[model samples]
Target: MPLRGILDRWNNQSLARQFLIAGGLVSLAAMMLVGAYVTTLIEAAVTRNSAASTALYVDSIIAPLLPDMKTSQRLDDVTTRALDETFGQGALGGKVVSFRLWRKDGTVLYATPDKSMVGKRLDPGEDLLTAFSGQMVAQFGSAEPRDASERSRDDPLLEIYNPILQPWSGEVVAVSEFYEVADEFQQSLHQAQLRSWLAVFGVTLAFFLLLSAIVFRGSRIIDHQQQALTQRVTELSELLSQNKALHARAQRASLRATALNESYLRRLGADLHDGPAQLVAYAALRVDSQLLTDPRTPHQAREKEVSTIKARLDEAMDEIRSICSGLVLPQIETAELPDVLKRAVDAHRQRTGLKVALSMTNGSKSLPPSAKICIYRFVQEALNNGFRHGGGVDQSVRQTFDNGNVVIEVADRGPGFDPASVGPDGLGLAGLRERIESLGGTFNIFTSKSGTTVRMSLNVQEMEQA
Candidate 1:
């Protein structure tokens, strides 16, 4: 119906059908060409070899009758009788039906049973000219219509014109024309031509079959290899997609890590400026004023001023130590998960002097060192936030292991502020969220007028093994 439809149908065809159609068309075209060429060659070969044999037979029997015709330019009485005896009334083995002796100028010297044609000059055609040139020429055709007598005896004839050579000189003197019945010989030639054609066709068919078989096997192998290549390409595409997703995740983690480092630096700067830096600056100012106002006013007063300065210096040192303690963590490489959480809670209690109710459930005790640090920091920050912002009432910390996950919750029964109204730099919630997510954990908060609860869950086995 359409070009596209034809293509679709051909594509849907089976491989065997497609190959067979193509091979058949190719074989037919090749055989047709070969058959035509072979037939032409065989015909030429058969004609050349058959003509040579027939001409040789005619020469041996007929050449003796015309030996002296060069000088006579005509056949004698004896030669004329001999010709009649050879060809008349089914004579000479019934092969020779008729005969003529011609001079070189196409003058008929003798004609058997047709004496009226004798001594008549006619045009010597191409076949007679070839014979007079010392070669025998033969063909199958009717006699020429130029002569009335020849036209009267018309039949399908095997005509031969042979040169009658002089015995001593080996020169052509006269030409002998003969017409023979060739029914049996024609049948044999036909049979040979038929056999040659069949043989050529058989060879062509066999060669085509062999070539088609080779093509079919190779096509099957190519199809299999193509299928394998397609499957391999699909698998590679899937792997590439997975690799791109992993790369994107790594980039996001890198950005979050940078943000966490910046937040940490900002917090450290603020702690130093508010605590140790302010105290140290004030002590320096007071020392400068005393030196300028009363360098030697009273020894006892200067001693008292030295005591106050010493107390202020001692307070500044304590504040610096407190900030340092917050920054530096205890060595807990060899500690258990429960022991690590207990240290954070004990430190909070020592610093704030506020009691926190703590509960724990049996869970995976072993953890990677990074995971231990995350847990301790999370508990520490949540407890500190509760005392500072939640009035430290009904504070509780709970730890449980559920379905291969470590779950932790910190809650307080105090008035909670709205998370939506929180300032950008308050309470380090964003840093806490990033910290938990970086470890492939989750952080969440539930706050209301009753209180606030901070919850975190981590894949214990995965985080520890990683």
Candidate 2:
């Protein structure tokens, strides 16, 4: 039952409660076991000493006097005297002796402090039966019932019992007992148990307090790290939002540039078709008519003049054709940049009678009409420059598409010119560069001892949807 209760308490308690309860229980059990062991040891030691002292008193005085005695009463008197001398006065509650004399037939012959117990039949079931059998008995403290007078007192009594022997025959004759109280010892043990319980409780509380402090510190560090992580996430979110806005703005700018280029090319095509082409046609007609009918005295000078006029007219036709070709713009959503580049190369070749090679890498994909027209004009300008200033008449123009970019390059095996010497005002290459860059594209020119190459990259996807 006690074990079951301890198990229940252990299971029901919280961690701290369990610790405290277990500590207290262990301290209590250990103290109680120690106290019980100490009491038993003291009792054993006291019993052994008392038995030895009683035997010595009996052997030296009572046992020697029994040889001279003639009757049981006389032997009783000698045993009483011996007990009084050994235990001293008032030691056995003013009795001076404590002894019970019995015969071999289990009859009581004498008892100290009273004569009424003499000649009494000894009931083996009554007090001192084991003593009559010649065995020693020992007890500590008093067991008497207290009356009102004795109940108010603080002191208690102690007791001891031993068997007496006969002289010469060495037979047991009577029993003897003594007692003394020990109230102070019980009080001291109770105080020590209380002190032990208090020390256990104090130590348990201190240990719990230390553990709580450590847990609090660790929790604080975790909270700080979580807070820092949250702040960093907030900062990154804001940065991403700003970056998206910048990208949107850049896309809008590219669309605007594309629109402007397309409009410019459309207007340029209109001007050339309506004005320069008509004028060039009229001049050709006049030259043909004059060559057929007009006659002069030399005819040689007239023929030369007519020939010069015809040549000028043809040059004007070529210029107007070149201008119109440069103005060729396709639909932004439908035209492929490579196809547009091919058309521009063909137009320039037809107009100038110059051998031009076109090569396309990757596949053709649609781009904004403005982007196509810009590339067309750039090629026109490059071809024109090569025709007028480049030493080589034949040139290779290569176009490449990769990922989402379209690269258009025009190179000639010409006497390469120094880009630094040709300032912005000297060659229209600077204007071409400006036009390409305005559309969110790049323009680059490389001139070496062998040749000159102009390259530009247009974002095909951006241009097609602009």
Candidate 3:
């Protein structure tokens, strides 16, 4: 299989199985190391203890019989005979497979059952050196040893190095090395090693089972939680689908209503311009014609009255035309967001004849036609309020896209009005807020003694979704 396929298969396995496989391999390696170390120590201890017992027995029998070598280098006939009697047919007969007594000068003083090998100048091995230094060394010649110096020999024997000290001065005068038939010792050593390995295996099994039980319990808990989380996620997905549908419906309704409201405003503006504004203009023209085209000479006070009436009619006509212009909006539905905002600022500048700072940065995102209309109306109302109340001082219009949301701000550095006094219904602010919120956007106004700011933030992503 490919590497990715293997990884996927491994990942698909249950958590418990994965841990069991991994932890079992680790445990097996640990058991092998611990068991080997512990059994090796057991075999060494048994070999030493058995060798010490045999060495102690041999030392007891022979050390008393041997002549003190502090005075004589060679053993006499009687002393040599006593040593022969002990190893040949006495207490150590069959158990002693081979025995040798060495002098400090490396000459064999005695050999078991055969005295011809006596007086042979054999060099001392490392074991003999240790015995000469007043220490006993022991080894099992048929078993694998933990240390190299305690290495096994060919025959099945327990090798012993017994140091013989002089009775009076406690000085080691001679060393005795013996090899005993180790059938019984080997049996005991093998039994001990087996028992030790069984104990290690038992401990390893108990530890592995205990850890596996704990992990299995934890894995079950995690699996249960995963199932519950999956179910909760499914429920949330359904609810989100329903919310999206409701939001789309609300967006459609808001669009339709806004279109109808704009249509009504346009008809109202056209009516005032054609009916009330035209009639007012005609009345002003008739009064001016009457004042100038009259044949009769008029009195001074009456002439002034006719001229004043015509001037008032002209003023009324101008005010009517202004109201009509305010009601009808420009054709901004097809324009982009930046162009729409520019048109609003330009119109405000021309009407008020005041400087309005307009700032645009990153207004390149595509917006819905309804959103563009909403933004235009928002800027229009906020600027008009700022001008009427703030004396049009230091007016600034800023537009930007902030984290996928379009933020437009209109602010003025003038004496601000108290928001609480205006309430929610005053200055058409309530209508503007309704209009913005209906399209899933936000409107906020901040007013203080230093200045006033009207900010509108719209989420372009949500608008696009709608």
Candidate 4:
């Protein structure tokens, strides 16, 4: 298949499976490249540094021996002693040296690994006789010997050959040799490669783990959203079914109920304005007249009566207002849901002297009166629940709007109750849920150790019909 087709197929798979495959491939490739690069660079640097350091060490050893060799007439003993001292058993403990001293006649005077090689004609290939003509030669490779059996079993070697120059004329006198075991340098390079692999392995493991976690979390969120959408669709289907059955009954009952509700609200409003308010005004006049005329009645008692009358009047006014608001509207109209929510929150805060925060986003637009009413009632019920159960008096309420949905969340630092433990008898939230779902919306109530949150989303199109 083409790469694009393969990717499309992979994309259709579960997020976790796709992530594991893609992450493993990418991580493995990157690790391999990094490992190769790091191992090569480190090995090269180590080889170069080791070679330079060894060369310097050899020069230091050979430099001091040059003067001693030029001054001595008895070259054999002087050369032997100098060789023994320079390549002392301890000095060549971790190194290999094959030194051969020669006279101007191209004959060997001393060769280490054996005293027998002395007095032998220098083999041009096996012995570096060209260095005797006042030249320094250094090569990193295996050594050759005249006797095959005397050759090194270890493969590669780093050898440095320097000529012994006469101080006066700078003429070549004798030669010095130094060779290093390559196994140590090779082992260092192998260790560097191992470290590179280990580092790459560690980073790859962490990368795969992080990728897996992201995939798992994203998959779970997708599943949750899908489930929520499915539930919402199911609810809407059921609501439509119920609406079909109730349409005839609603036509018969809704008009009468709405008329009666409006009439009751207007009567209640008039009763409050005409009854308790007027009664309170008359009682205040009585108290004022008593305070001015009656010296028999104590001032404190008169003042107590006046305060009691005022408290009763306030309670009566509140009762009347509550009764009137509980009545449903007679006619519906398109209203912006956020504006209704803001008014509800504002009214609650004003009555309780609590702080409220309202945030609206997107362009303010109109919604169906039913959705506005449902959302307004949801906020009202939530605030009531907060006051009754959440100890939300003098607390803060926050409402947020996004897209075409409004989220009214009232939180209090007061003692919270577990939503899971709420019984069937708790009709407040049940009724709120019914109202919200009646308009093809979703309702979610979340309560935790910190506080409680009630979230509901209304479909903008459906809400416009309401």
Candidate 5:
């Protein structure tokens, strides 16, 4: 479980980091293995070459001085002096630590620097037995040394077994073992091993660096592509949300348009019934009056009644004209936003004799025909309501731009009415809400004892597109 957890953490790291960790471990192992192998080979080759040269020089000096072990396992006094002079005064003088001649039965036949060791019998070790079998065995103290050999000193020592050959028969005779001081050989071997390790390390480091560079470059590319993909997804999500909102607005507008025709006809019928229809009916009743039908009625009285009927008919005609005037819209489709607002305010002031302050700033001049119509009606109706309910004190109409949308606000400093108390009738507030929302706009009303504010926000960009 711990190993699984460790692997999970490792996998979570970036590609560059992962490659650096794994490659570093592998490179370390490879450097150590290869370096150790190369160093071993160099040490072995240096030891063998140095020991062989030293053994040949010693054999030339000491070989002929030895008595043939085939005849006797002892050395003559003359032969002992010859060996001692050779080691003491010759080329192997300081370097030769000790020397010995061994018979086949592990008897020390001759010895130098310690003549008491002569005639002492010792056990024949593996190296001595091999030397008697006609092969030289050489070892260096710095690398591997035998425990009981005379060459096992604190300083580096090279020990060798050089076998003596009989003159006549080529039979195994005896073994000569000697130890040499080997400071130069040890220094050369160390230098060779150091160079081999450095070469291996250099090669391994270069290879790891090249791999790391490539991995890091590819990781950067992958990270960049992932960021770009994430950004693209965010953009697409915003576009989808906008499309859904647009589709919802379209559906509302379609339903509102379908109901508008029926509403208009019903309002027209109600107006005619309340104003012209009543007056026309009253005039017809006056026409069938008993005074006009009776022949005995006086001419003067009849003339007075006839004049009264004419006045009533004229009043009825005026009522019909007023209704027609309220139903028809003025020409405002091609007018700019400022002109549209001015017309509405002026028409209300002319009709009701009320002062309305109109202010516009940062308002879009270009708009759709439907937006212009809606704006005009909104201003006209809002002003009428303010005058009726709030006494129209400080009446003001404002048109402004906010974040690409046009805001229209009608405010008055009067005792405001409760919004909850407003009833659904006469298409006053309800029609205003429908008109604004059909275009995907928003309407809000804020009321208090100090003042009332009715605001509508329309998207100028959407209207321009329409």
Candidate 6:
């Protein structure tokens, strides 16, 4: 459970905190390895120096008493007294605690205060062998091998083994083993270890702090960029929402414009049929009644008068019919786009006797009724303009599909008028633009000195149904 808690805390930590923790752990491991190695080296050096100094002190006290510090020769009464005086109290001002001498064969030659072990043989271990090889060995503990003397002495001691040399030959012959009271030495070694550990900890902490600072700065930068990105996303969402609303409003306005244009066309058609047609019918009746009058004048004079009046009335009626034809449209509500366009061109050729080249491809049966009517009327008007303003020759109407939109183009080889010189009151082009635009379509006119072309494109899928 404790392990789980630690893992959970680590998981929930911020990136900078996690980074610092990981780096700190790695740094701690590195510091521990270096500190342990250095401490081991320091321990070895202190032990070597202490052993050498202890060996020197022991040798100085024992060298004069024994003529052969190496051999297993029995000690005399004078030498025995010297050994007791040196080690029973302490050697070198009470620094030494106990002492022993060994033969090369592992036999105990002498030990102060333990005279019973004088001739007992024991195994010479690795430390004893090292001393016999002319090296000193020391440790801060009781001596080993579980001997009776070691069992009786339990106090912490500096156990040292010093090699005794043959003075004349300079050869190691025996080893001297002894112990020293180590209360002060143990305390001093512990103090050194503590100082070394403190130094290592301080350095590790300083390095960890420096690394944490760098990680903290990077984390803050990441957080700031993330916040800015979030804000940008929010603003983009708002803009998209607003764009959708404006598009809806534009669709509503276009639908309103289309309805108004249709209303105007209906009103114009009604006015021509009701007002001008009635006036022409009444005038024709009056002229016929006058011709039927009896004996008003001589026959030829009356006939010429009636003929002149009849010709003028017929001319007026023809002009009114032409105006009415332009205002009213055929029943093209159920016709397809291609059929509607063909009907308009066919009617123009019948009325004006002008041949129009036609290029058409079949499709767009899905086009709405209003779109079909608009196409028909636009084509009819364009053909009329070609016959009146243009030469009425070499005209063409092309209908095709481009990118899901139906395109109709009418062209004429006529003297073209400048668009800039045309006034806003040019109802033909202006009404065409508004009609196409309302149905989510576009109208464009391209004119050169040689010819004039008007093109209309409509997307029936986007148009409002009527």
Which is the leading candidate under TM-score?
A: 5
Give every collision pair in model 5.
none
Candidate 2 per-residue lDDT, tens place, 5-54, comes to: 98897787655555455555765576566656655665566555655564
How far off is model 1, as Cα RMSD? 8.7
| Candidate 2 residue runs with Cα over 4 Å from true position | 1-322, 328-333, 425-427, 461-466
Best by lDDT: 5
Q: In what order do the candidates fall by lDDT, top score first?
A: 5, 3, 1, 6, 4, 2
What's the TM-score of each model vs. the native? 0.54, 0.39, 0.51, 0.37, 0.69, 0.53
Model 2, CA-based lDDT: 0.63
User: Candidate 4: what lDDT?
Assistant: 0.67
Tens-digit lDDT string for candidate 1 (1-466): 6999999999998676788888789778887887778767775576657766776776776666654776897677787777777666423537766677888888998875567879999898898999999888777644443335545663445777878888889888888787766676677667877887788779978887788788778888888888999999999999899778757866776787786688788888988888888888888887876643686758787777777777888998998899889888898777988888889989988998889888998754677888788888899898888888999888989999878888899999989878888665454676677678878898999999999999998998887677
Q: Model 5 TM-score?
A: 0.69
Among all windows of 10 consecutive residues in model 4, the one with the lowest summed lDDT is 141-150
The total of clashing pairs for model 1 equals 0
Clashes of 6: 0
Compared with the true structure, all predictions reach lDDT values of 0.79, 0.63, 0.82, 0.67, 0.84, 0.78
- The residue-by-residue lDDT of candidate 4 on 1-466, one tens digit each, is 6999987998798877777887889888998898888887876667657766775666566566544555543345664677677666546645754666655556766667666777777555434666776656655444454334447455566566667677678887776555667777777767877988898889888988987898899989998999999999999999999888668555544554555456556766687777766767766676567664687879788777778767767876776666566555423355465567667787677766767556555565666667767767777778878877877744444555666565656556556777778764345776676566656678887776677777887767556655
Residue ranges of candidate 3 with Cα displaced over 4 Å: 1-14, 142-155, 250-466
Kindly report which residue stretches of model 4 are placed more than 4 angstroms away from their true locations once superposed.
1-9, 67-81, 84-90, 97-152, 155-178, 182-189, 237-466
lDDT of 6: 0.78
Look at candidate 6 and give me any clashing residue pairs. Answer: none
